[model samples]
Target: MLWLDLEGAVNVRDVGGIPTDDGEKIARGRLLRSDNLQNLSPTDINFLVENVRLSTVVDLRSPAEVTSEGPAPLTRIDRVLHVNHSLLPEHGFAATAEALLVRRKREEERYPGDPSCAHYLGYVEHRPDSIVAALRAVNRSAGAALVHCAAGKDRTGVVVAFALTVAGARREDIIRDYAATGERLDRILDRLRRSPTYAGSIDSVPEDHHRPRAETMEAFLEQVDKRHGGVLSVLGGNGFTDDEFDALHRKLRR
Candidate 1:
C-alpha cells in the first residue's frame, strides 16, 4: 500500500515517520528515493517539480549509465548532483560485462570469490561516500530531494538504509523500505536485460542472469553488517558529526 505520486519514476517513496534515535520520526516528503527518472512521464515530472517541491537530485549510478540513459528531461529543481557509484558501472554494452568482472574480482578478494557476496558486500563498503554526499545535499536543500540509481535498489538502498538507521528507524522498518523494490523493479530490469547494451555485454549468459534476486538483497544487508560494522559506523566514518547526526534525527523525525 506504500506509494508515491511521481508519474514516470517507479520506486519513489518518502522516508518520513520512520523512527530515529531518541524516539523521533523522520519527516515524510522531505527525502525521496527512486530509480532513474530518465523516462518519467510529463505529468509525473510536473507533479514532482510543482508538488513534491524537490530542490535537488542525487544520482548514484555510474558515469556510463548517465551518458547512455541520460536523466529525466524535466526538473523544475535547479541542481542535480551526479556522483555515480563506481560499483554500478554505467549501463552499456561493453561496460556491463567489464563492470561485472571487476565486481567478481573484488568479491573474490573479500569473500574468497563468492559472486553473490562479492556483488553485495563491495557496494556496502564503498557506498558511504555517496550516502554522505546525498545527506549533505539534503541537509542543505530548502525543500524536497530525491536520490536514485538505475534500479533504485542497490546503491540507493544502502543510502536509504543508512539514513533510516541514523534517524532511528527500526531494522524491520529499514528492511521494509528496501523490500518495497520487489514490486517495482521488474520493468526497469526487463528493459535493461533486453537492450543490446546489456545483451551484448554477456555472451552466453541468459537474460535472467543479469537481474538481481531476493537472495541478493538479503546478502547485501548481511554484508553491510559484516563489513561496515553496521550502518552507524559507516555513517560516522563518512564524516557524520555527532551534532549533525542529532540534527538529522531532529529534522527527519517528528
Candidate 2:
C-alpha cells in the first residue's frame, strides 16, 4: 500500500503492487482509494490530475450527503469523469439513532459473529446495482480511478476488495490493504470530525468503531465465498458479463 501525500485527504493509498495468485501484480496508477475529495486543495488536484493521471472518480457517498456537502473539488475538473454509486438508500441518513439501531439489528441477523463483517456483506446484498456501476466505472477509466467514501473504510473497502478479488489479487494482500486504513484512522477521523457532513454522526460513534480490523475483512471474504461462491460469481450474478470482467481484470492486473 503506497500512501499518497495529499495535503487534504487522509487514508489515501495506491492499491498497486499487490501480488496476485498467478504471479502478476496490480499496476500502479491504475487504481487508488481515499477517504474523501471534498477538501482537496488546488495543489492536491494538480498532483492527482497531472502526476497520478487520475481520470475517473467513483464516489460512494449517498445522495443526501452529496447534496449536503455540495460538489467536491474534482467536480470542477473537466477531464475527470465523476461517477456516483451510492451503496445505500437516499434517505438512509435521515435519523442517526434510528439508522444505527436498524443497522445493528440487520447486522446481528446477518452475521452473529462480527458487526463489521455483516455491514460489509450488506453492501453487496442491498445494492448490487451500485456495486456493478462502481466496477464498470473503474473498468472504463482511461487512467487511475480513485474510489472514495466519507471514511473510505467501509463502502470503499468493500468495492475495492471486490475489485482486487476479481483481479486475482491474493486474499492476504487484499486483507492487508483493507487493514492498512487502521494505521491512519486517527487522521481520517480527525478530517471527518472537521466536516459538518460527517461530524455529528462520527462523534456519536465509539473510537474503536473507527478502527479497521483484519478479521472483519477476512470474514467478509469468507462470506463472499460462502454466499456467492466467490467474487466472480457475485459479479456475474449482478449482471457483470464475461467481457466486462475481463476488461476490469486487464485494467488492474499487470
- Which candidate leads in TM-score? 2
Residues 1-254 of candidate 2 have per-residue lDDT tens digits of 78998898988899999999999899999999999888899999999999999999999988888888899999999999999999885456542655676777777789987888888888888888899999999999999999999989999999999999889999999999999999999998898888887876776668887799999999999988999898788889989999998899999987
TM-score of each: 0.78, 0.96
lDDT digits (tens) for residues 71-108 of candidate 1: 45754334544344444423322346666676567667
Pairs that collide, model 2:
none
Residue 34 Cα positional deviation in candidate 2, in Å, after optimal superposition: 0.5
What is the alpha-carbon lDDT for the whole of candidate 1? 0.65
**How many angstroms is residue 8 displaced in model 1 relative to the true structure, after the best TM-score fit?**
2.0
